[model samples]
Target: MKITFTLDTIDKAAEEILSQCQYKTLLFYGEMGAGKTTLIKSLTKALGITQTTGSPTFGIVNIYEGNGETIHHFDMYRLKKEEEAFDIGFEEYLTSPYWNFIEWPEKVSSLLPTNTTKINLKILDHTTRLCTIDNGSNELK
Candidate 1:
């Protein structure tokens, strides 16, 4: 599914994304300042998370709990190599039955599961963005 949204409509965009996703793992792809983290914050809220959420850039990952579900958010932008993911037990997290939201997933592309969903965001202006979600199908649906 594809959506065009502004900060004012981000919540609705997040809900639409959740409804269209086919897997628990979501890989976010976007350039710097493209609103990846902003969208994630909206998504976490949609998933019933009441706490504030932010990019895990320095921490690598952040674990959030809400609505009887555990969410693992990862930021791979700082990794010098993909092997670094192993050092963090990323594989173990991937195998879990919880939700996973990964930023800079291209850094660990080979490790991603085939069933994962990919959300690509593009900045259209200062406050507008175009979001294209693909269900790991190569072609956007």
Candidate 2:
């Protein structure tokens, strides 16, 4: 599925789309200033999450308590090597029940799940974005 939006409507559109796909590992792909974090925030909010969430660039990972599950938000931009990801137990986090939203996943490309839902965000203009969802997903309640 592909969706286009301006920055102002991206959040709402993301929320609706994410709600249709429940409890799936989400990969956010985009360049700098592409509104990846903003989309994650919208997803969390749409999933009944009330806690605040920000980029995990510095902390590496931030956990949020949703209604009954954990939201593991990760930033691998600072990761230096594959060993570093293992040192931080990336596998454990990925396999866990927590809803993991990863940023800069290219740093640890080998570990990303093949069946993952990839959210590719492209910058059209300063405020416009093109998001493509190509995860073989079916509509869900």
Most TM-score-accurate candidate = 1
- In candidate 1, position 10 carries an lDDT of 99
lDDT digits (tens) for residues 1-141 of candidate 1:
789999999999999999999999999999999999999999999999998788899999999998887899999999999999998899999999999999998899788888889999999999999999888752234
* TM value for model 2: 0.88
Question: Over the stretch 53-122, how does candidate 2's per-residue lDDT look in tens digits?
Answer: 8999988888888688678888888988867888778899988877889888777778877656778889
lDDT of the candidates, in the order given: 0.92, 0.79
Candidate 2, residue 15: Cα displacement in angstroms equals 2.7
TM-score on alpha carbons, each prediction:
0.95, 0.88
TM-score of 1: 0.95
Off by over 4 Å in 2: 19-23, 136-141
